[model samples]
Target: MVVMMSPFKGQTGFKRILNATGYSLAGLRAAFTGEAAFRQLLLINLVLVPLAFFLDVSRVERALMVAVCVLALIVELLNSAVEAAIDRISLELHPLSKNAKDMGSAAQFTALCLIGLVWAIILLG
Candidate 1:
């Protein structure tokens, strides 16, 4: 029997972890420079995270507030990656591609909503 390996999956162990970290950083750079939505969400985070620290909320509430902000950024990163992957596959308009992109957008939207809901409850309740 014969098996095939992905050329991109060559790294292993500690070296793989280092390479993965570098790749993740590069992806973050790319998203920061190229993706407007990511930048917007990051700006929002910059405001919300620090505000969380200053607020009179309990430690857990502050953490929850900051966590939701981070969650939104994570979701935006994922959504951008999905859009980039779909574009890399092909620019042609197709239903599957449209659906994939739309779903990614929806996920980001939901994350943003979660951020708002969590913050409101923690701040106002």
Candidate 2:
């Protein structure tokens, strides 16, 4: 048997850490520049995270509120990645591709709902 590996996966140790960090930053930049939904979520995070600090909530509540906002960004990133990958595979319409993209959108929708629920509970309850 033979194993195949990506040439880009060969880095190890400190060099790998540096390369991974660069790649991660690039991914973030790409999302921020290319994905409208990501930019919108980021704007929301800019508002909500700082607002979390000014609220009179306990530390744990503040953390929870900030966390949900961050979670939405993370979900949006994953959703964007999924859509990009699917588009890369094929731009032509296919049922499976549509399903995959739809599932990713649904995941982001759920994350957004979670943010609303968490913020509402913390601010009102």
Question: Taking the tens digit of each residue's C-alpha lDDT, what string does model 1 give over 10-125?
Answer: 99999999999999999999999999999999999999999999999999999999999999999999999999999999999999999999999999999999999999998789
Model 1, runs deviating above 4 Å: 1-4
The lDDT per prediction is: 0.95, 0.95
Off by over 4 Å in 2: 1-4
- Model 1: weakest 10-residue lDDT segment is 116-125
> Which residue pairs overlap in candidate 1's backbone?
none
Superpose all Cα atoms of candidate 1 onto the true structure and report the RMSD in Å to 1 decimal.
Answer: 1.5
Q: Candidate 1 — number of clashing residue pairs?
A: 0
Q: What is the model-wide C-alpha lDDT for candidate 1?
A: 0.95
